[model samples]
Target: MPAVSIDINMFWQIINFFILVFIFNKYFKAPLMKLMDTRKEKIAAEFSEAQKNNEDAALKNKEAQKILKDAKDEATKIVQLAEKKADERKEIIISEATVQRDKMLKSAELEIQKMKHAAKKELEVEMNQLAVTLAEKIIKENLNSDLEAALADKFIDEVGGVK
Candidate 1:
C-alpha cells in the first residue's frame, strides 16, 4: 500500500457513531422488537378465532336449512293425511244420507197402503148397512105413495141433498 493519510476528525466521528448505535441497541431495540412480536401474535390469534367463528356459522346455517326442509316435508304429509280423512268422512256422510232417504221413502209407501185399506173397509160397511135397511123397509111398507116417498127421500139423502 501507498502512504495512508489518517484524518483525526473523521476518526472521532466514526467512534461517536458506534457509541450512539450501541446505546440505541441496548436501550430501545429489544423492547421495540418484543412489542412488534406481541402485536403480531395478537393479530394471528384474532384471525384464527374469526376463521373458527365463520366455520361455526356455516355449520349452523346448514343445520337450519335441514330443519326447514324437514318442517316442510312434515307439513306436506300432514296435509295429505287430512285430505284422506276428509274424503273418508265425506263418503260416510253420503252413505248415511242415502240410507235415510231410502227409509223415508219406504215409510211413506207403507202409510199410503194403510190409508187405502182403511178407506175400502169403511165403504164396504156402509154398503152392507144400506142394503139391509132397504130390505127391511120394503117388507114393512105398502107398495104405494109412502114407499115411493121414502125411496125418493133416501135417494135425495144419498145424493147429498142435490135432487
Candidate 2:
C-alpha cells in the first residue's frame, strides 16, 4: 500500500462547532431555558405568599384567644356584682320584716294595757256600789250601835285590802 497522507485544519473545526451551537440555540435551547426559569420564579413567589398568610393566621388566632379571655372575665365580674346586690336586697328585706314585727308586738302590748285599765275601772265602780248597798241594808235592819260600828270597820278593812 502507498503511504497515507493526513490533512487536519483547526479553522474548519472551529467553524463547525459555531454552526452546531447556533442551530441548537435557535431550535430548542432558548425556549426550554426560559420556561424553566419562569417556573422556578413562580414557585418561589408562591412559597413566600404561603408563609405570609400563615403568619397572619397565627396573629389572628392570638387576638381571638385574648378577646375570649376578656369576655369571660367580664362575665364573671358581672355575675359577682349581681350576687352582691342580691345579698344586699335580702338583708334589707330581713331588716324591714324585723321592724314590722317589733311594731306589731309593741301595738299589741299597748292594746292589752288599755283593756286591763278599763276592766280595773269597772271593777272599782262595782265594788263601791256593792259596799254602799250593804251599808244601807244594815242601817235599815236596825242593828245595835256597837254591832254597826264593828261591821263598818270590817267592811273598810276588806275594801282597803283589795288591789
Candidate 3:
C-alpha cells in the first residue's frame, strides 16, 4: 500500500509540472517573443541610423575641408592682388616725387641765374655812371697837378662804390 501511494504521488508531481509548462506556453510565450522581437527591431533601426549618421559626418567633413582649401586659395589671390596694387601705387608716388624734385631744382637754378644777371647789370650801370662823372670832371677842371690828383682820388672812390 505504501509503495503504491509513493508511485501515485510521483505521478501527480509530474502531471502538475506539465500543466504549469502548458500554462506558461499559453499565457506568456507569445507576448515574451513579441517583446523580444520589438526590442531587436528597435536595436537594428538605431544601428542603421548610426551608420547613416556616420556616413553623413564623413561627407560633411570632406565638404568642410574643400571649403577651407578654397577659402585659403581665395585669400592668397586677394593678398597677391593687394600687393600688386600697392607696388604699382608705390611706383606712381615715387615717380611723382621725382618729377616734383626735378621741377624744384630747375626753378632754383633759373632763380639763381636771374639774380646773377641782375647783379651784373647793376655793376655795369655803376661803371657807366663813374665814367661819365670822370669825363665831366676832366672837361670842367684845368690840367693842374692838384686838380689831376683830386680827379684820380674821385675815380678811385667811384670805382670802390661800384664794387
Candidate 4:
C-alpha cells in the first residue's frame, strides 16, 4: 500500500483514552475512596466521645455545688441551735440566782427581828430589877416617917409598871 485510506481517522486515540480511564478506576480510585471513608468514621467517633466527656464533667460540677450548699445550710442551723441553747441556759441561771438571793434576804430579815425583840425584853427585865433594889434601899434608910411610907408605895407602883 503506497498510501493509507482516512476512514479510521482518530479511532485508535479514543480507544487508548478509554483503557487508561478504566485502569485508573480499578486500581487507584476504589482504594482512595475506601481510605477516605475509614478516616471520616474515625474522626466522627472521636468527636462523639469528646461530647460525652463534656456532659459528664458538667454533671459532676452540678453535684459538687449542691453538696456545698447543703453543708453550709447545715452549719448555719447548728450555730443557731447552739445560740438558742445558750440563751435558755443563761435565763435558767439568772432565775435560780434570783430565787436564792430572795431566800437569803428573807432569812436575814427574820433573824434581825428576833434579835431586836430579845434585846427589848432583856432591857425591860434589867430596868425592873434595878428599880426594886433602889426602892428597898430608900425604905430601909427612912422607915420612921409618914413621908417615907408614901414614898415606898409610889416606888413600888413605878417598878410594877415597867413590863
Candidate 5:
C-alpha cells in the first residue's frame, strides 16, 4: 500500500527452496516410505505366523490328552482281564484239591476194609484149630478125616452159621 520494493534476494530464496524440495522428494521421500511399508508388512506376517503356531500347539495338546485317556482305558481293561483269569485259576485249583481229597479218603476206606477182612479170616482159622484140639482132648483120641469134617460142620452150624 506504501512504496512497493522488489528485492532480488527474495527471488533467489524462492528458487533455493524449490531446489531443496525437489532433491528431498527424488532422493529421500520415496525410499523412506517404501522402507516403512516393507517393515509394516514384515511385522504383519510375523504376527500371522505366531498365531498359527499357537493354534498348532493347542491342537497337539488336545491330541496328547486324548492319547493319555485311551491308554488309561486300555490299562483298566487289562487289569480287569487279569483279575478274571486269576479267579478262574483259583476255582480250578480248589476243584482239583477237592477231587484229590475225596479220592484219598475212598482209598483209605478200601484199605481199612481189606485189613478188617484179613483179621477176621485169621481169627476164624484160630477158632477152628482150637475147637479141633478140644474135641481130640475130650475124646482121648485123634479123629479120622471123615469124623473131623462132620464135627467141624456141626460146630459151625451151632455157632449161628458163622463163616
Candidate 6:
C-alpha cells in the first residue's frame, strides 16, 4: 500500500484563500452589487416618468381636438342664426312696403270719389238753370220766382230723378 502524505503548505493555502474571499466580499463585491441595484432603480424611475409624460401629452392632444371641433360647430350655428334673422328682416320690410302701397291706393280712390261727387253737384245746378230759361222762352214771358221754381220741379220729374 502507498503511504498518504499531508503537507503544512496545503493548510496555509486554504487559509490564504478564505482570507482573500472575505476581503473581496467586504471591499469590492458588496459595493459593486449595491451600485448595480441603484443604477437599475434609477433607470426604472426614469422610464416610468417618461411613460406618464407621454400619457399626459396624449390627453392634452385629445382635449385640443375637442375644443377645435366645438368652435367649428358654434360658428356654424351663429351663421345659421344670422341668416335666419336676415330673412325675417327682409320679409318684414316687404310687408311694410306692401301696406304702405295699399294705403296710398285707398287714399287715391277716395279723392277720385270726392271729385266725382263735386262735379255731379255742379252739373245738377247748371241743368236746373237751363230748365228755367227754357220754360221762360216757351211761355214767351219772364217768369216769377215761384213759377220758375215750379217749372223746374216739373222738368226734373219728367226726366229720371237725380241720383
Q: Pick the candidate with the highest lDDT.
A: 3
- The residue pairs found clashing in candidate 2 are none
TM-score of each: 0.66, 0.64, 0.72, 0.61, 0.66, 0.55
TM-score of 3: 0.72
In the range 88-131, model 1's lDDT, one tens digit per residue, is: 99999999999999999999999999999998888877776676
lDDT of every predicted structure (CA atoms) = 0.84, 0.85, 0.88, 0.86, 0.86, 0.84
Model 5, TM vs. native: 0.66
lDDT of 1 at 22: 97
Candidate 6 TM-score, C-alpha based? 0.55
Off by over 4 Å in 3: 1-13, 138-163
Residue pair clashes in candidate 5: none
The candidate, 3 or 6, that scores higher on TM-score is 3
Give the Å shift of residue 161 in candidate 4: 14
The C-alpha stretches of model 4 lying farther than 4 A from their native spots are 1-43, 144-163
User: Model 6: which ten-residue window has the lowest total lDDT?
Assistant: 135-144
Residue pairs in steric clash, candidate 4? none
Per-residue lDDT over 1-163 for candidate 6, one digit per residue giving the tens place of the 0 to 100 score: 4486557997899899999999999899988999999999999999999999999999999999999999999999999999999999999999999999999999999999999999999998788767756754664455557778587557655653443
Candidate 1 local lDDT, residue 66: 100
- The CA root-mean-square deviation of candidate 5, after full C-alpha superposition on the true structure, stands at 6.6
Who is ahead in TM-score, 4 or 5? Answer: 5
Model 1: residue 145 alpha-carbon error in angstroms: 14
